[model samples]
Target: MEPDDMLQTVDSVSFDRLVLEDSGRMAVEFMSYGCGYCRTIEPIVQRVASMIAAEETVLRVNIAADPELAKRYEITGTPTFVMFLNGSEVGRTEGPAPTQSAVIDAITRPFMS
Candidate 1:
């Protein structure tokens, strides 16, 4: 399926339903509204999300908006991407600095491997 890169801003409940409930999806990005890095790469994340969002759920969580959710997910940083496949945690990209292409490469790497 061809996924759109439009960034989705989700709340805690919506995030749970979208990411935890879903399986075999490409990726989800956990971010914070107050993080400068998150803002910097918002466009990149959106592009990556659009590219592979067809059958996957690409959600952006604002850690600051929902601290409990961030803590539940053990997200201690901003602009972190937690990728899953078949309801399993495959891998994650942390500390930002990833470009749009790089974000796509990271999540799709598991498929390639």
Candidate 2:
């Protein structure tokens, strides 16, 4: 599926359902409209998500749009990445990811077990 189709908006209420009940792997990209780093990493996130199969999903949450989620996660900056497996956060990275390989590595590392 396309990255656009794979992306989901995560909020306080829907967060549990999207990350937990499904028990599916997810990559959450936390970003803001005004963040240059977020914009720069957007395409890399999309490409990595697209390269992955249907079983895995990459979700984009706008910190500007969802301040509640940002506060909940203690997100102080843009371009933060969180990987979830079975509804719990497994790994996270802050700032520009640099490349799709770094994203792919973060997303799949926990599953390597």
Q: Which candidate is the best by lDDT?
A: 2
lDDT of candidate 2 over 1-113, digit per residue (tens): 33465566777678778876768888788888698887687777777777886768888788887888888788888788777888788877787466878778877676666
What lDDT does the true structure give each of the candidates? 0.71, 0.77
Root-mean-square deviation of Cα positions for candidate 2 versus the true structure, in angstroms: 2.6
Model 1 agreement with the true structure over 1-113: per-residue lDDT tens digits: 12553767777777766666676674767777677887788777777766676766676777778788778778878777877777677878786565766777766665555
Candidate 2 error regions (>4 Å): 1-6
Counting only residues 3 or more apart in sequence or on different chains, how many pairs clash (N, Cα, C under 3 Å) in candidate 2?
1
Q: Looking at candidate 1, what is the lDDT of residue 31?
A: 79
Model 1 residue 8 CA deviation (Å) reads 2.1
For residue 64, model 2's alpha carbon misses the true position, in angstroms, by 0.6
Q: What TM-scores do the predictions have? A: 0.79, 0.83
lDDT of 2 at 43: 79
Q: Per the 3 Å backbone cut-off, how many clashing residue pairs does candidate 1 have?
A: 5
